[model samples]
Target: MKKILALVLALALVLSCASALAAKVGVSMPTKDLQRWNQDGEYMEKLLTEAGFEAELQYASNDVPTQLNQVETMIDDGCEVIVIAAIEGSSLGAALDKAAEKGVKVIAYDRLLMDNANVDYYATFDNFKVGVVQGEFVEKALDLANAAGPFTFEFTAGDPGDNNAGFFFNGAMSVLKKYIDEGKIVVTSGQTEFADVATPTWKTDVAQKRAEDILTANYADGKKIDAWVCSNDSTALGVTNALEDNYDVDTLGWPIITGQDCDIANTKNMIAGKQSMSVFKDTRTLAAQVVKMVGQILAGETVDVNDEETYNNNVKVVPSFLCDPVFANAENYKTILIDSGYYTEDQLQ
Candidate 1:
């Protein structure tokens, strides 16, 4: 009896020691409404769990105050580290300050916060590169169509509140502007003409309505619109749906559409020639890298910011890890997303 009791006690001690070595991490994501974020959250959770750490995640749903309160709770719960996909950089100042006061490390995931305060680290894709790729694809697609007689193309941007959106827009615009300036692609009616850019939430319904309005007011008036440079998959769905159901858009040769986030539906559309291409940022690789960072931080080791890149916000330089972005069209769909086990062939089909 005495020997058994001693062995039990020893086992308990080992378990306790293991748990103590594992970090307690809290993750606050911007929104769960989008498919990519959902996958990101799930992947991160699984990775953290496998690393023997506890992960507490909160969805802001684009709500700043809610995220702030959640962070405060995490601090009170004695989290050692924090990962935030901030809804808005400006509103997260107080939460970050509290984390800093507690000496807890923070990582800005996918988007850089603008507060100018010290953010420990960031993990995301090369968003600017995503835009540039989209631009090049757009120009190529247009040229392939031999889109004759100089027609005006429409521009639809993401929500202006997201800093990443601006980066994406700017990246694509860098290539698009060159053509616009040289009279290759004309800018027709959009946020510029309406005096407020198309900064709608990532809702297909809203994008569809916007496209319907454009077709009704502009196309009906004898103005022939040519291509559409949609920012992401959801917006592309909206524009495509409007064109198909409302306006018989097939007659327009399915303008050069763009998207991101290799959602199953979007991938199918790309395969079927309904959409153009999407930027494929492997969430599995991203999740693994973040888990590795957390492991190092938990083990009382410092993050190696020397090799990581830095991006400036309003006040401070944010150390960031920019992962490579892969452009996926019909050619590399199976090789990139399917074979990597990000999703199954059946899910996409």
Candidate 2:
């Protein structure tokens, strides 16, 4: 009986030690202003905690200084691993240096961390493919290849600070540029350049003002725009607002708009015919993958990464795990989003 009791106590002590050694994980998101970031933070926190890790989640309100400070604090607080969704990709070099000093592992979440060899892993959707999907959606809608004459379209891309912005813009442009060269599509606003059309901070007001200017200059006659290829939901929201506030979309015909993130407002707009489609990269699946990666890392096992050559952060080729993205529109938002429990019907309504 005493030997059995001793065995029980040993098992209890082992369990106690395991609990005490649970590694703390830091999840730093760019902003809570966007619905997707909030969901990402929540999901990462939940999944990490459930996986028996201590999780610290924070939002930086889209401020680079705030994000740097938060990451510094996470490192100082003894976080074993830190996951960052950068407000600005190139701005985290110093903080990552600090993390490296403390031997903390870094994972760039959603957004790539630039100019830093300290980034150990990258986990995000295939962002260029996201743009390709958006471009394809526009292609199918306009029937660009099969159709005879020209179609009018506009561009509204993401923040210049985001590294993914170029990937998104270039991927879409790769498909649509050929058509433009062939005179199969026209840029009515004459704002085709990335530097000209790139929105700062991906701000809705900024994009809306730009769109308003373009409309005033070129679309005042209520000429129909065939499409607007926006990099994400917020910019698409701006374009939709510009159409509503400044243009006679009813008579001129609402143009097809492409977006990413499948944001609540954008999905509602898709339902309401204001926005056309969004790229759906489900965050829960990504969170789960990151959690699994965390376990592998802590266990001193090899972490699963699919793409080793794609994401070059200007320091080294950062290993990456790229989740595939698909288009979500009025037609399949029900199955892809609501039914999959990514969002509920009422939340969208």
Candidate 3:
């Protein structure tokens, strides 16, 4: 009877030991202003919880210092791993360094921090490829227009301070500059003509006013712009609004405008024949990969990222994973966003 009781007790102890091995993870997000980030965070939380790890999430509301403080707090809370979507790449250096010294694993989500090397893993879409697609889409759209003479245009880029923003702008401009040199597309006010081309924070009002001012000065000089290459959906929408407010979009022939992010309003606008196209980098796939990585880390299994690479200040050629980005126009609007459950028919309508 004592032997039987002892065996049962030993089994219970083993079960308790198994349960205690599961760890707590900390997730810090820069902001939830963008719909994708919010979705990504929720997906990560759900997956981590289901995998038997506790998740503590915090949002910085776009404040860099606040993100730093949150990381410090997560480290102090004895978190086994920290996932960061840093608000500003430069400001995150100090916090990441400190987290490394504590022997905590760090995963850089979406945007990689260039200044630090403490990150153990990174999962993000091919941001440079995203820009390339945006540029190529603009090129194709312009070819369809087949304008008669030189076409004047303007470019509205994202926050200049961010490295990803610069890559996006550079990639887009690389293709755009081809036409500009060939004199096929006339850039009246952009990196060449406009004095204020650097967008610091991606503020909507600032974008609107800049477009308004550009149209007032450049386009008003008897030069009708054939296209406007706004970087992302938000900026593209602002530029579209400014154009419509100032001049008749119908009369202007709705200058071929390009945008990214697959934003709800922008996707709807694409269906309604307003915007041209948007680059859709599915956040769901990205979230799933991140969850898988977290699970691997928890199980003491190695995650594979040899196919992906990025340069960090501390670690050159950091292992990373990048997914493909799709350019969604009117044709694939339903098939991509709706069919994939990213948006519903009612949502688009």
Task: Please list all clashing residue pairs in model 2, or write none if there are none.
Answer: none
Estimate, for each residue in 1-349, the C-alpha lDDT of model 2 and write its tens digit.
9999999999998986596458899999999888889999998899898888999899999999999999999999999999999999999999999999999999999899999899999999998898899999999898888998699999999999999999999989988999999999999888888898999989999999999999899988878888999999999999899989888987877899999999999999999988899999998888888888888787778999999999999999999999999999999999999999988989998
Winner on lDDT between 1 and 2 is: 2
Count of clashing residue pairs in every prediction? 2, 0, 0
Give residue 80's lDDT in candidate 2 (0 to 100).
Answer: 90
Q: Cα miss at 317, model 2 (Å)?
A: 0.3
* Candidate 1 wrongly placed segments (more than 4 Å): 1-20, 144-151, 190-195, 221-224, 304-310
Give the 10-residue window scoring lowest on summed lDDT in candidate 1.
190-199
Enumerate residue pairs that collide in model 3.
none
Point to the candidate with the largest TM-score.
2
Per-model lDDT:
0.77, 0.92, 0.77
List, residue by residue over 20-129, the lDDT tens digit for candidate 1. Answer: 56668998887877888888888898889877899898888877799889988998898888888887766788878889899988888887877648588887888888
TM-score of each: 0.88, 0.95, 0.89
Error of 3 at 202 (Å): 2.5
